[model samples]
Target: MERPFSVFHYGGTTSYDAHGGRRSRDIPAGEAGSGLGGGGLHRLHHHTDHDGRPAPHREAHSESGHGWERLVFSNALQAVSIVSVVQCGVGLSNADVVPKYGFGPIIKFLKVLVVQQILWAVSLSLCKIAILLLYSKIFATRAMVMAARIMAGFTAVWTVITVLIAFFICRPLSDNWLLDLKNRNCGNQPAADGTMGVLNMITDIAVLVMPISYLWKLRLETYKKVALIVTFSLGVL
Candidate 1:
């Protein structure tokens, strides 16, 4: 009698007997292996069916197994990050535009500035929500899940309010870019911006602290727990 084991390859799985003879039907390729041509050990395991036949299993790669929420949030983060970079490039170009183009470009710059502010709020909120979702997924405790949900909701609401404030800070909307427009009534723009900035920082601090309590209660050693907490806290910086 020969012992049987399964070999997982990039394209598919193959099982072999003790004599190196192929024993089972080739398993359809799974998403488990790196696509590199030269195969290395991905995983090795052996199992026998109740009647003494080799049992082959399909293994799912981490990327393929990620939940939809992870995909959605991560893609959204990437999209917003790309847009933010483009906005920064536009901003840099404005320096040259002002020297050559004068006030004509200033309005455009101010408009871009407003959009950039909203983008900042959206990007930050998405990041925080993604982190909170990860916390819920990883910790899975009732308290952690509830806290994550509450914080996520609050971050989303804050983003919505911030965008609204940025968009509507000036009556007639054009007042944001038309600095010299007559009879344009706008809120204290600088003060509103400052308040929003402070609130953003406060949320950052709250997110940083939310996981510390749960981490401290983990069965990890004190030094390990402290290290983990420090790692998570780096997001604030």
Candidate 2:
């Protein structure tokens, strides 16, 4: 008597038979191939119950409970950053006053500039923190969550240090924007500025690259991986 047989059709054309209670054997292409016109085995294996499809580990929480915090923080950062930029532009526009009023007016402008810098640092730090929180919300991997926490800590520390550097760059604190430049002693402003710029870029790059490794490790096609990389790359710009 013939062994019990079953015909399983998948991927458009290919069918499989179970013989002697063993694993199903895929019919070779061109033999019973009449389905999707491709390798029946390929589609069967990849699309078995949509196994190959990317599944979200968690629901995206961008505007729900904790997600609402991310939105608020991001909006506040944008507002503060815009104000700082406008303040800087106004300060620079006073170029004529600098020559006409001597160091006094320029010193006053520097005071305002210093305040703007503080605002910028605060906004930037908050922006990074918000991004990390969003990452933690979307990706459920322990590595991703831990990385976000670490980066948030780094951002907080950087904010504190940069603000302190800005405030104490000039001695007596009041001498920062005062006209008593001849007798006042100020720290290396240029060096501090350069250092902060480098640190800012470094942190930004760190945030941009943080999720790349996790994304690359995912079981996704190369095109999908590249798309994800591009999405994160927007943060840099």
Candidate 3:
């Protein structure tokens, strides 16, 4: 059966044909790739069932591991959507949509927005870390578990560094000896970022290859091993 999809964006609307390919455009109207209708919501149309249903698809079996993996992936996708939407909303809104007559008004609004942005990034990064941990579990080995721990540790360190960057590591704080926590930068950032980048690349290389290597020596299908490696790489990606 053909899948049902109607992506409404730019100046055009597209729907799937019975063969799951493009049907003719019902409307062609704004800027290309705007991902939005010009100054308004775009319209969409789809083929429907007699019961007036729309965009139905196959159901997952309850016992399927694939279904669970999809759930994890989708949860990660949800974080992506939430961050985009919230940031977009803030960008589209005025500093004070209902204006007040003071510097305090704009500053307060900006402070709230900045805090929200940090929260969004932290949540998304943590979700990504968790998804990688799940990937390690699915293809578990002694080395894979170690990789997971190392990745998790990096996540924690990065998160702390992010907090320090956001608050304590400002230029003003840098010169204040009493408040300063470290002489070196708290981030994994090196004096030469390339040094740190190489270290990260090496770690990612080991994490990506080690599990797949272990899986390969087992008698799993070639396709399965390749798929696992590909999906695991996406976590680091």
RMSD of each: 11.4, 11.5, 18.2
Residue-pair clashes per prediction, in order, are 0, 4, 2
List the candidates' TM-scores in order. Answer: 0.59, 0.59, 0.38
lDDT of 2 at 105: 49
Q: Which run of 10 residues does model 2 get worst, by summed lDDT?
A: 40-49
Backbone clash pairs for candidate 1 read none
Give lDDT tens digits, candidate 2, residues 1-237: 554433333212323223323344654323332334422212222122243222223333323455454465566656654654454343354666556555554554566667667777876787788888766644434777898898899889988999998888887787777666687788888898898889888888888987676556444567876787788789645
Error of 1 at 56 (Å): 16
Candidate 1 similarity to native, TM-score = 0.59
lDDT leader? 1
Ordered list by lDDT, greatest first: 1, 2, 3
TM-score of 3: 0.38
Candidate 1 ranges beyond 4 A from true positions? 1-100
Cα deviation of 54, candidate 2, in Å: 24
- lDDT computed for candidate 3: 0.49
Candidate 1 minimal-lDDT segment of 10 residues: 32-41
**What is the C-alpha lDDT profile of model 3 across 108-127, one tens digit per residue?**
44444334434544554465
Clashes of 3: 2
